[model samples]
Target: MDLIRDDDENNSISANPPEGYVEPGWPALYSALHQDPQYLYQPYAIWRFTLYWTLLFYGFVFLVTGLLLLLNFTKRHPRLALLSFALWILSSLLLGLISSTIVAYALAALYNAAFLRMSTWVPPLWGAVQVLLLIFSAAANVPFFTG
Candidate 1:
């Protein structure tokens, strides 16, 4: 299988190359993974939905924990409180990591599709977006912080 090369002389481009000769890039990958290029939108939509629900769960937990703490729920049920705290921290951390991973995968999928153009800047921009979201999620509890 021969890879397609850009012919400068002809100034023409082949968007869909023949099968078995998958180009060593996102375009080829996108074509291979999806039967219809429009399906490329699915992963990103799912990623966003997951992030939204995860954040919502975190906010609900924070509120419930804070309210119970006011009534000295921890002192009454020390073990339960400790367990809840531990679980909340671990789950949130795990979810964040997983969310970032899914986002990265979605970005790769986008690259394979025609939605995102190939560029060196993509990696850094993606990293920055992930970092910013993590920071925002972490800071969501600031208003309830006793300290």
Candidate 2:
């Protein structure tokens, strides 16, 4: 979806005019009436981008952890090991609240799948933590069902 505006169709949402005057300066309410559409208009794209960031952060933790584990297998790099572990925990704590709850949940699910597939998969602990965070985020997203 274009963040700008469509050059094709004009916005048609309007109330009947009082007598014969055009309703002036209500373009803010009818955003597409002008030449720019607001961020909210592209819900799916906005959500996807936010989710990508959250997933990217989470995946970075797993990637770093896996690298550290590979180093441990070869020899020892205590400083790098500690730093990677710390970052993994921080990523877990921050991913969910960084954006929309639904986006966060989507990212967690994506991260889990990728982590599970790596040949030297990161340890399972981070994935478990992400699952729990996803539960919390999903609950937060559930509105009062009108059903």
Candidate 3:
């Protein structure tokens, strides 16, 4: 008795896929792999995902700083505060987003290659770098600090 079917119509798992069936590319493959429960449960995957969230949280830091400036300085020097806020948005926020994106992608790659134990420090190190950037950017734009 024949174990394998040679007829293409009868065979469900054919050696050659039908026309117009495009194989998933690297981004699709990575997306599927990242969604897998087993892959997500791994320590490296956890840290890699966490790095993305950490970047988002850093963005919130800028938001809070802008809010605080509006609340405090609006009463005394509204125009100066508004200009400072605009400058902060143009300089600090844009710089932070660009820098964070680069760092986050780099850190995710590192997390993929690093051992679980070594990967633990990636988020904190990223946080420290962001904090320094935040300080410098704020000082460069803020009226009091610039003076």
Indicate which candidate wins on lDDT: 3
How many backbone clashes does every candidate have? 0, 0, 0
Give residue 111's lDDT in candidate 2 (0 to 100).
41
Better of 1 and 2 by TM-score: 1
- Which has the higher lDDT value, candidate number 2 or candidate number 3? 3
Between 1 and 3, whose TM-score is larger?
3
The models' CA-based lDDT, in order, is: 0.50, 0.43, 0.53
For candidate 2, write residues 1-147 as lDDT tens digits: 533322226332122212333222211223345644322212233344444444555666556655667577444767767676666566654653454455434544554333321111121223445555765676677785323
Q: Rank all candidate structures by their TM-score, best first, as comma-separated numbers.
A: 3, 1, 2
lDDT for model 2:
0.43
| TM-score of model number 3 | 0.40
Deviating ranges (above 4 Å) for candidate 3: 1-55, 108-147
* Predicted candidate 3 versus true structure: per-residue lDDT over 1-147, tens digit per residue: 744333445533223334554433212223334653112213334344445544555556766787788788999999999988777656655665566666655655554344222223344467567767767886899888766
Off by over 4 Å in 2: 1-38, 74-101, 104-147
The residue-by-residue lDDT of candidate 1 on 24-109, one tens digit each, is 32222234355423222234433443354444554455546555654465777888777777676666657655765676567756
After TM-score superposition, what is the CA distance of residue 25 in candidate 3 from its true location, in Å? 16
- Give TM-scores for every candidate, taking all chains together and pairing residue i with residue i: 0.34, 0.27, 0.40
Q: How many backbone clashes does candidate 1 have?
A: 0
